[model samples]
Target chain A: MNHPWTGPRLARVALLLAVAVFGPAAGPRSGFETMSPELRAMQQDDLANPGMLHVAEGEAQFQQQGCTACHSAEAMQGVAARYPAFDAARDGPIDLAGRIAQCREERQGRAPLPREGKEMLALSVFVAHQSRGLPLTPNPDPRMEFVRRQGEALFRERRGQLNLSCGQCHDDNAGRRLAGSLIPEGHANGYPLYRLEWQGLGSLQRRLRNCMVGVRSEPFAPGAAEYIALEAFLAERARGLVVETPAVRP
Target chain B: MARTLLRVPGTAQRGEVVEIRTLIQHPMETGFRPGADGTVQPRDIIRRFTCLYNNRPVFEADLHPAIAANPYLTFTFVARESGVLAFIWEGDNGFSQTETRALTVA
Candidate 1:
């Protein structure tokens, strides 16, 4: 019998078990599918979804910041689906928020917004909202391959006091109960989502940090390269999943 | 400044019941919570929400600390005549916001 206590061995076993049960290629499913009917209803109703408030705030910011001077709302459609794109200036992959921050600094000649601040969240939500209902389309630039691989490694690497990889719960035990909450497949299609736990809209990075903390691991600093890499990987992993920016999560 | 969202039917038949939904962004900090510095954060919450139809009060609610951040309220009012509907929220820290929407009734 294979020992299941070793980190890599356990992770491999978990993956094999997942593949055995789910088949070689399981269809991408959204976290929305796992939510209760009430939450699903909440997410569907624009009037009731609190995340729309951020979208409104973002709209105001977009106009006030002269974003309309270069990009109209129509021009922004499907932009979010192609995130974590290669940034030649940074010589690295940059997520949508990072790209926005860079634009504010380079093009708008303004200070970058704080990563987790309200202004940033509003802008991200607003930009992402443009891509709502579109599929996540990862950047096809060959340079992104390295970062995507790094993200996959991070997803499968076991760490923290619990010695758990993200795939262990999100991939292997998806749909299973954990502390009374169903484990989702950890797709990034609906990001800058409004989580009831946070009582506010937050970026995928915030959720990732929360998970890291859950496993007793030190989270990467906000806007870190690692987070961007992971985002790139998640984008590819969640390919074809429709964007649900500002989605409500219970 | 807090962002607010208001939804109302653009037109309705006279005597028809119409639903009005409003959502506003606010922390609604319950004074009982401690801040990062470990001191009790002073309470800040939207204490009241009032809706006026044609300059007359139609709905009013007294919000408390228990209300979640980003308060959302949905209520109904009878359509009578074409007029402006006003929403006003009052809260601690001298917070207040007023928004108006026009409803056409046939």
Candidate 2:
């Protein structure tokens, strides 16, 4: 229901406004060339000065609980902009939670948390806030087009023994709830989202797989082509929705 | 009221880890609290469960009050062991429900 602005001229105008606001007045490292030294430092101060009420919990868990050894707030900044990315290394796309869990498994020398759990939710929410107000950006890898098309087809297609496609419930009934929980519009944007019921967080794939079960259909494999296509379709739909990974949702 | 699922982890190795999750529609009332008045509500809930792999017991568990209503349970097995995962839920008043899913490990 939110009208968004998109166009080259608008973007150009905004860029000029940004330059004027930051240039000369802010002095030294004002332009994009001298970016990090002063610009980043200023933004970081503004970003860190006032934090979300919920982020405190995750920060506590990360720093005091030793999660900082693996990830830091600064490192996660703008990270949500590039999620649901095609990882040729794994030969597929992985959601933010999966990436977090991957590091927890291989690099941090720790056990991975369950796909959706409070631990992951708090962490994901905390991490996503770092990229607040950033633009939604998804990779437009050429090789992924095939999968993206498939997912889009599936979204609009009805399936399952129950004869329901994801779009029927999600797009048609965006603001309704199923049992007791309020249903989100169900955008894949900001996934690896934090859900209150699970008291946890997980990737978009995990939620999609669960929906398949609810609809009496077999879920695709964890990293299957079916899911990648689905991811592509969702990301395209969520374009310009802003990056709010780790956003809190009931 | 019995719900059954065929949980094949993947297609490659019938020896791969496969899980079948089942949930039954039961109030699963853990009778202890009073009913309408101060009268004690009789406990009537699913008391026992057994899962059979091709007609043999491969998994089993006892139910308690701590379990949520309409219980869901998942059983995992090594793949290539093609069989049927049948679930049986029985309660205090002889209330029972049964369902099954045909599974191919390979």
Candidate 3:
């Protein structure tokens, strides 16, 4: 039988030891960099990435639904950057998905699609895709202080059978592996992304729900204000990072 | 609802090897897994995909249950003349979708 510590394994051990002793050679990288080359290529290719499909569909809906009569796609540029903003009408923080739902109801004079429905998700993806490369710049508002504080508490509070909070993995153990995948810093810069696990484009709330389920916690409903607050905190934390809308994650 | 997306070059030089890509929203269920109630879910998957240039076949694939949901494919073909590229997907439950794109060759 081959020796367990010989060759590449030994080299890997040596590399890990060096890293442990000397610390990492460089600053943190987006979880994007940790992906396979093929997945990276897919994220870079507009045509090959499946997430683009949803964005394209959203573009169609934007025009057909009469949004273009009021605003051009260019006008929506950088609009997503200010999402998870305070909405006085809702009396709470609202994410891009929530904002889109409100607009559909009030402006389009139509019943709003479910926040997580395909059409709404696609429309939000399409709108956010226009803001690609912009920074996560959620506008500051004094009214949102309470929500932001709540979000911080939730992020830090231990929950579920695992008794782990978002900070435990994303803040402390980031870059480490829990299962087969590396735990990212959990930035909200790239959202309405296509996750290979879901095999479809999903909102950040969907991802958050998945995280809750992973920890055996009861997930909040799709449109619950809790997710919006969490999103607000994440957006604030990820401020200045360029948006990677329609991001592909495995 | 099943939605399809195609990526074809809007403009290309004559005889260039243009890359065309396609993706479709599908579950591609394998019938192997149990549902929330512990009963086996039925199998449903897209089985065939075809791309036609100027009404002539250029690329095709026969997908299996093992394929992931939202099947994505990329293929290359010679840009001979300005024409239309038609993409077709056929699968279980009598599901089929066709989308077309225009190509300009100089």
For model 2 chain A, the run of ten residues with the poorest summed lDDT: A25-34
DockQ of each: 0.72, 0.01, 0.55
TM-score per model over all chains = 0.90, 0.47, 0.83
Residue-wise C-alpha lDDT for candidate 3, range A3-94, written one tens digit per residue: 11232445445655766777754233355656789997888777677888888789988988888888899998898988878888867787
By lDDT, the best candidate is 1
- In model 2, which runs have C-alpha deviations exceeding 4 angstroms? A1-54, A64-71, A169-185, A190-210, A220-229, A245-250, B1-106
What lDDT score goes with residue A24 in model 2? 27
lDDT of each: 0.88, 0.61, 0.82
Per-residue lDDT tens digits of candidate 2, residues A157-229?
8878999988888777654667865455566655555443333446567788888998999888765667767
Of all true interface contacts, what fraction is found in model 2? 0.00
Best by TM-score: 1
Instruction: List model 1 lDDT by residue over B1-106, tens digit each.
Output: 6778778899999999999989998999999998899999999999999999998999999999878999999999899999999999999999999999999999
lDDT of 1 by residue, A1-250 (tens): 1111232445445555776799745567778767899998788777788998988989998999888989998888899999989999988888888888888999889987887898888989999998887778899999999999999999999979999999999889987899888898899988899999888898999999999999999999878899988999999999977788879898
Worst 10 residues of 1 chain A by lDDT: A1-10
> What i-RMS does every model get?
1.0, 16.5, 1.7
For the record, the alpha-carbon RMSD of candidate 2 to the native fold, in angstroms, is: 22.1
Q: Point out the higher-scoring one by lDDT: 1 or 2.
A: 1
